[model samples]
Target: MSAWLFDLGNSRLKAAPLGEDGLPGDVLAFAHDGMALAAGWDSVLPPRIDAAHVASVAAPALRVALLDALAARAGRISLASTQPAWAGLRIAYAEPAKLGVDRFLTLLAARRRGGASLLVGVGTALTIDLVDAGGRHHGGRIAPSPTMMREALHARAAQLPAVGGGYRVFAADTGDALASGCLGAALALVGQSREAAVDACGGPVALLLHGGGAEALLPHLADAVHAPALVLEGLACWARPDGARR
Candidate 1:
């Protein structure tokens, strides 16, 4: 592939090839860590990548390092940023730049389906955004994600383990309780947002679920679409010749 797409999130880095259909193909994920900066990245990277498009919600240092590495291989590199509006989608933020580009791009990709929709991204944070059929954004909410909640609890209370637990309807153990509570909180938010979107749009709204933590919520969330790389999908869109800002 001539064009490469990179999505750098707080916890991970994902890359894929930009297909002829303007969508990403076969995503590859890498864990984010200070050690092993290069970490066999060059081994997996495409040999003749000509241009690279990136959407980053990672630290500035990570972004610089990743972009610099890509720059060495690709002649052109475009970093996506939040905009007031793009690709027929208008952001609800009064100061649009304050909105995260991952959120922005996810909305861009979601609204392209041409209907009322709610976007629920489960990552370092759980971000929710609503958009109507016409691509008019109706704002969103942000909260600590299930994983973050677990981490916070573990940090504050020594006995709580951050990593071991499974969501259950009724937890008989503390670990299960923590997992259930955190995940249930996210589910409730999505449920409420779906109802609100239905009322606001005067019709049923499709819920698009994305990010690393999305799968755990999937079996519980009926009538929802799982998009593991929605941000990368939007990066592909933004990489288009016409989608680029002047």
Candidate 2:
């Protein structure tokens, strides 16, 4: 089947073909704002696809627009939702619906790695989730990502630029200081989460990072596995025939 996986996030739309081995092929990402939606997909997606499996954490309007676009090109479309328990990975949420599907799908991919993991997603928001070797979730934390922090600070104080500067332990300039402070906050949170996960899981936990901003934090973290296409990988799992039972 010529199936494709779509991960619609807060700022961008990521798509990839699902290979026979149940992994995502080369990923293609598009910004959902400013550009004409139809034009963006038209230039990138194939002429037609047999199936399109989507996991969206975008705004409702954007989600509806994506579905509309897919309707014209795909024979079948499946939307992934958070499940309390599926394929051995159990959620920690009392109300499963409240959990973002991106985080849920990230956990699905993390569990497949077969070990205790601390999954951190750095996008518009920084999300940290921990899953044990047994596929049991121990909950997570969410906060404004460094990019968002910069944007927020810029909004309040126009002099602080929203998008430049290198991360430093102690920056002499305002831009670098902003970068350092915001990124440091996220790094600290991840560090704390890893420590907590180690205590809860009774051993050292694997650290997995994903999302658009993950690359920026990679240098500071040792032995962290960067899986930029994790959500799409999870979507690939959901697209499988035995996905629900696996």
Candidate 3:
């Protein structure tokens, strides 16, 4: 059966189809409303997809609308949750139900690729989760994205110009200094978390990075696996024959 996957992240909504065609289609990112992204799903499906899997961290009502739309087109649909499952991947969260589905899926993807991996999702917000060697999901950290950091400085503080993504050793002067401060700080938080997870896990860890900032931030990641489609891949696995974990 074909698989359609959706990851509802903090900033954008991402969807993918799993098949023999190689890579999943380009990820579509839109505001958390789900309106703009939902409209495009139907047009992209080839003959017809057999199944759909959605892992949403958005509000229940928003998820309901998106699920209704997908169910109307594809009959088999699975909604991911943070609940502890009987099998598949072991969840280590004290309260798995409160954990974000996207984060769980990301950990699953990292485990499938290789255990003890650091899953970093850099979208509207930056998230760094660790799957320990013993198969426990040790949760993760969240920080404002590079873009958000830049925008916040501008919006909240005076004389803080808005800046885009770029690489610099760390700014020395005001404009470049502020831009570098925002971007560098964001990356530093993510990188440090990844390192901490590795240390805490007591072994080498594979770093998987994904989301809207993947392309822009890939270069800055000197020690990451650079799996830009991680969320999509995890979504595909969630829709697979044995997709859930305990």
Give the per-residue lDDT digits (tens) of candidate 2, residues 63-170. 888898999999999999998987789999999999999999999998877899999999989999999999999999999999999999999999899988888999
TM-score of 3: 0.83
RMSD of candidates 1 onward, in order: 1.7, 1.5, 3.1
Q: After superposition on all CA atoms, how large is the RMSD of candidate 1? A: 1.7
**lDDT, ranked from best to worst:** 2, 1, 3
Would you list the C-alpha lDDT of every candidate in the order shown? 0.88, 0.90, 0.71
Clashes of each: 0, 0, 2
Instruction: Compare the candidates by lDDT and give the number of the best one.
Output: 2
Ranked by TM-score, the better of candidates 1 and 2 is: 2
* Candidate 2 weakest ten by summed lDDT: 34-43
Q: What does candidate 3's lDDT look like per residue over 91-165, in tens digits? A: 777778877787777776776676688787777787888886666777778888877787788899867778743
Model 2 TM-score on a 0 to 1 scale: 0.95
List TM-score per model, in order: 0.95, 0.95, 0.83
Runs in model 3 with CA error above 4 Å?
Answer: 20-41, 85-88, 170-173, 242-246
Candidate with the larger TM-score of 2 and 3: 2
- Candidate with better lDDT, 1 vs 3: 1
